[model samples]
Structure formats: C-alpha cells, structure tokens
Target: MKKTPSIIAAALVLGAAPAFAGSATPAAPEPVIEQAAPVPFSSPDWTGFYGGAQLGYANIDTSAGGDDDGFIGGLTAGYDFDLGQWVVGGGLDYDFADISIAGGAADLESVFRAKLRGGYKIGNGLLYATGGYALADTNTLGSDDGYFIGAGYEYLINQSFSVGGEVLYHEFDNYNSSGVDVDATTVQVRGTFRF
Candidate 1:
C-alpha cells in the first residue's frame, strides 16, 4: 500500500511538471521585423538675389551715315523668383565705352539699363528674354533715353555664382538732340555672384 501511494504521488508530480513548464514565462516573443521608412522627394531651389559683371562688343549704326564698333564692359545686379520650371527677375546695369562715331564726329561713352527678364529652367540652365529702358551717353553730344530688347542664357555654377551671355539691340532717337537716330547692338559675356 505504501508503494501504491508513492506511485500515485510520483504520477501526480509528473503531471504537475508539465503544468509548471507551460506556466513558465513564455519563450521570448519571436524577434519583430520592421521595414525602413521611405524618403521624401523634392526639386531644386533657385530663388535669390545676384550681382555681376559683363564684357563684350558693341556695333553702332547711325541714320546720319556713320557706323562703328568697339568693346563694352559693365556691372550688373538683379533679383529672381523661382516658380517650379520658370523664373522671373529684374536687373540693372551700367556699361562704359569709348566707341567713336565712324565719321569722327563724336564718341559713345556709357550706357545704363533697368531691365525685366522671364526664363525657362532646364537642367541648371536658364534661357531667357529681357527688355527695358536704357540711357545712352555721349562724350560730345550729351545723353539720351532709349529702349532695348534681348535674349540670353545663364548657367548656374553653384549656389552663389553664374555665367551667361546676352545680345541686345538698342535705339536712341534723335540722339542727344543732335537730329541723329542711333542704333546699337551689344553682345556680352556675363559673370554673376548670387546671394
């Protein structure tokens, strides 16, 4: 009878062993796996202010039978606003020249301009059209008000620098009140500093 009781006790202990094993802290939960989050997409930014210099050639034609050509150079400053694929801006420039009239009657001295430009952006390059008011000065005849229109292309070298070129046509009627109509075409290579 004692052997029977001991056997019964052993069986009960064995049965309780499985129950204790099940109740033990669950095996550490399976390692969790997570995916990395996606990155955001964006476009290039090009809104700012700028300033620069230019050097190029000027060819002049006069209604009074005189024509001439020479070198011109100047300073420029501007501001721009970026609009997705397009940009618009305003600029001002002043150029000094020493071009003489073909007939030795006078010399063209300087030019000043206030301009507006609109451009299309394509892979770091800007193709634009510009037009505005101009003032032409002469060494002898005086200075006169004029207008100019032109096209240009500028490439961004970085966040603070750019290079470009422009070709403009200008008209000064009855130049400096001397009863001479003057037409000038200027081609310039430009370098700019942006802020």
Candidate 2:
C-alpha cells in the first residue's frame, strides 16, 4: 500500500514539474503588426487678391496715318475666384505707352483698362483670356475710348507669387475729336504678388 502511494506521488511530481517548467519559459508572444498611415493628396490653391507689374512691347496703327511701335509698362490689380479646375477674375490696369507717330512728333501717352478674365487650371499654371474697356491718351489727338481683348498664361512660383505673359489688342474709333481709327497690340511679361 505504501509503495503504491509513493509511485502515485512520483507520477504526480513528474507531471507537475513539466507544467511549472513550461510557465518559466513561455512561448514568445505573436509579433505586433503595424499598418502604414495613408498618404495625403495635395494640389495647388488659387483663390485670392493679387497685384503686379507688367512690361512689354506696344504697336499702334492709326487709320488716318501709319504704324508706330514702342515700349509699354504697367501695374495691375485683381481678385480671383477658384472654382475646381476653373478660375474667374476681374482686374484693372494702367499703362504708360511710349509709341509715337511714324513720321510725326505726336505720340500715344497712357492707357487705362478694366477687364474680366477666365482661366483653366493646368498643373500649377493658368491659361486665360481677358476682354474689357480701355481709355487711352494721345499727345496730339486727345483721349480716346476703346475696347481690348487679351490672352495670357500664368504659373505660380510659390504660395505668394506668380509670373505670367500676355498679349492684348486695343481698338478705338473716331479717336479724340478727330474722325480717325486706332488699333494697338501689346505683348507683356507680368509678375504678381498674391494674397
């Protein structure tokens, strides 16, 4: 009977030894997997007020006379509306033109214009067209009222600045007090500060 009890105790100790040993050297826990964060989508934003300077070439043709070409420099200001991939805006500009009559001492003085602009967004640049009214001064003929049409392309250099180029045509009938017609074309490079 005592031998039987000793054999049972030994069996119990042998079984319990493995269980205690297993507790001391447990299986390694499963590795914690981590998922990467999703990447953010980004695009340029173009909604604000802007002002700039323009410098370019001007060619003026008068119906009663000949053609004259000279330098044009100006300042511009506008506000833009950004609608998805399209942009709409309105602006005003004043220019100092130095064109003179082909064979006379008279010259074109300055120009003031009001325009509406529309553009399509491509990457970080905008391709646009503008049309509006223009008033021009002459050294001999006096002040003339006209209309203008233009097109341009502008690219954002950063968050606060942009650069662009434009070409515009201006037409006037019965210039000043004279019964003469006038047409002028200008090509300009522009730099702008955005807000």
Candidate 3:
C-alpha cells in the first residue's frame, strides 16, 4: 500500500512538472516582413545620326534700293557629336526664291544660295551662326555676288528633327553695275534634320 501511494505521488509530480514547463513563445510572430523586387540594369549608350528638310520665308532688304520677301525650301544633313549639353557639327544648305524690289514693279529673278554652318545646342534648342559665300541671278538693274554672316536659334522636337529662325547680312561690291557697295539683310525661319 505504501508503494502504491509513492507511485501515485510520482505520477502527479511528473504531470505538474510538464505543465510548469513553458510553451514555445509562439516563434516570435514570424517577423511580419516584406521584401522589395530587384532593379533592372541598363545598357551603355552610343551616338546616333539623323537627317531632314526645311521650308521657311525669307525677307531680303537691299541697301541700294528696296526690300523683297519670298518662300524658300531646302534639305539639311548633319552629324551630332553627343557632347553632353551641346552638339557640334557642320552642314550644307541651299534655297531658291523669286524676289522683287521697288514697289513690286522691279523684279529680280531666282536667288540661289548655299552655306556651311556650325552650332551649339542649349537644352532642346540650339544657338548657332554661319558665314558663307553666295551666288544669285541678275538684280533688277544688274548682277552681283557677296558673302553673308548670320545667327539663328533652333528648337529640337525629337532626336531627328528641329526648326529655327535666322537673320543674315550680305555685302556686295559693284552692286547693280553702279560701282557702289551695297548691303542686304535677310530674316528667315528654317527646319533641320540631325544625322
């Protein structure tokens, strides 16, 4: 009977000991965490090329006599150097137009021109200037030849296209067979393509 009592006590002690032992503290609530996605890598860059056409109005003011205005059209080809905020390049341009002087009565035939240019880019726009030689048909009184200097600004619409405006001054010797030196100024708006 004493043995039975001792065994029962031992059983009770073992049960109570298991109850006093702590439960596993619930594993710290699984850390409640979120993770972000990895970012993608980008490729290295290279310089590109472009080309386009231009159409604009030209106004010519002659020192000897009068003023003339007409439509001009041409093509442009250029290269961009990818020089950070600025692009440097050379280009060729030509245009043809019919002009009149003195009360729209005295007419000059087609005036043809070609020029070489260099420019720098500012944001989406470009600030530039050019100087070149020019050839033209006969004036109302006679024929002439000269050099021109001009400044302009252009706004780029995309990687391949832009439009702008310019003003140029021209000086001719022996203008119109009069042995007189003459000066002319022109203002024009133009478009261009980059290549």
Candidate 4:
C-alpha cells in the first residue's frame, strides 16, 4: 500500500513540470519619463557706473513773458543701485544751450546740475523720475541757481549700451539779482555706456 502511494505522487509531479517549463513569466515595465518646461528670462542687471551724452531742445520762459527755444547738448555720469524691480541713482551733468530769449537780446550759455533718480523696471526698459539743483549761466542774466524736475524712459540696447528720452522743467527765482524769474523746459534724447 505504501509503495502504491509513492508511485502516484511521483507521476503527479512529473505531469505538472512540463506545463510551466515552455512559457516564461513577463518582466515588470519601466516607469514613464516626463520632461519639464523651461523658464522665461527676466530684466537685466542695472547695478553699475554709467556715462553718456544727451542732446535736446530747450524752451525757456521768463517772467518778462519771453520765450527762448533752441538746441541743448550735455554729458552725464552716474552710479545706479538695482533693488530688484526698483533702481535708484545720482548723477552729475553739464549742458550747453543755444537758446535765445527776449528777441536774441538774452541767450542761455550753460547749465550744471546734480540730480537724484528713482525708477521702476518695465520689461527691457526703465521709467524714472529725477529732481535736482541747477546752476545756470546766461549771456545777459549772468549765473543763477535753480531747481529742476524731470521724467524719462530708457531702453537697454545691450549689456553695455542704453538709450532714452527725457523731459525736464527748471526754475530760477530772482535771476541775475533782477526781479525777473526764469523757467526752462527741455526735451532730450540720451545715449549711455555702462561700466
């Protein structure tokens, strides 16, 4: 009886072996890979020293009701600090004017200014406002001290170059020790090189 049972178990094992032998089990699949999108670029760095030149039109008004209009040119130098989206700086500039007022009897000679500027970064450009003290010389009015306020827009051409436009108003009280007042409004275009 024991020999019969042993023979039966052996036959069952031999029969089950061939069914699993011919077919191999499949392997686990690899995980799917996904790529990420790139990020966009932001504004350029504006922390540096800069020097430039400017040319523009000047329109002068006097308390005597005279209007002086002509060309103006200048040089500028400044340092800027970029605090993320805001920029602040101070600059010194000198301008020579060819403006004639009082029917060519009085002409503007030169202007020297020290100014402070604050701006916001907008795309590839900067929009700014400036205020400063001005010292002006005239052919007949001599030299007078004054103040100026202005606004401008500047665009970066590259890492080293920029271009801009500005509008400013200047006022002098009791000019040339005379009872007369002088005011000048200017529209200018500027180019700058950064270092």
Cα-based lDDT for every prediction: 0.91, 0.89, 0.62, 0.90
lDDT, candidate 3, 1-195, per-residue tens: 779999999999998885688674654566667687887553211134545666666566554566677775555555545565554555555555666654464444544455655666666676777777765554455666777888888777765667778777777666656664555566667666654
The lDDT of model 3 is 0.62
Instruction: For residue 163, give model 1's deviation from the true position in Å.
Output: 0.4
- What is the Å distance of residue 177 in model 2 from its true position? 3.8
Off by over 4 Å in 3: 1-51, 78-82, 102-106, 112-114, 139-143, 176-182
Q: Rank the candidates by lDDT, best first.
A: 1, 4, 2, 3
Cα RMSD, each candidate? 6.4, 5.4, 7.1, 6.5
Candidate 1 lDDT over 1-195, as tens digits, reads 669999999999998997877866768889889988887654355689899899999999998887799999999999999998999999999999999973778898999999999999878889999999999988788899999999999999887889999999999999877899999999999999899
CA deviation > 4 Å runs, candidate 1: 1-43
Q: TM-score for model 3?
A: 0.59
Write down the TM-score of every candidate. Answer: 0.78, 0.79, 0.59, 0.81
CA shift of 145, model 3, Å: 2.6
Evaluated at residue 118, the lDDT of candidate 2 is: 97
Give Cα distance to truth, residue 135, candidate 4, Å. 1.0
Query: Which whole-number lDDT from 0 to 100 does residue 119 have in model 4?
Result: 99
Query: Which model scores highest in TM-score?
Result: 4
Across 33-91, the per-residue lDDT of candidate 4 in tens digits comes to 88877877789989999999999999998887778789999998899899999999999
The residue pairs found clashing in candidate 2 are none
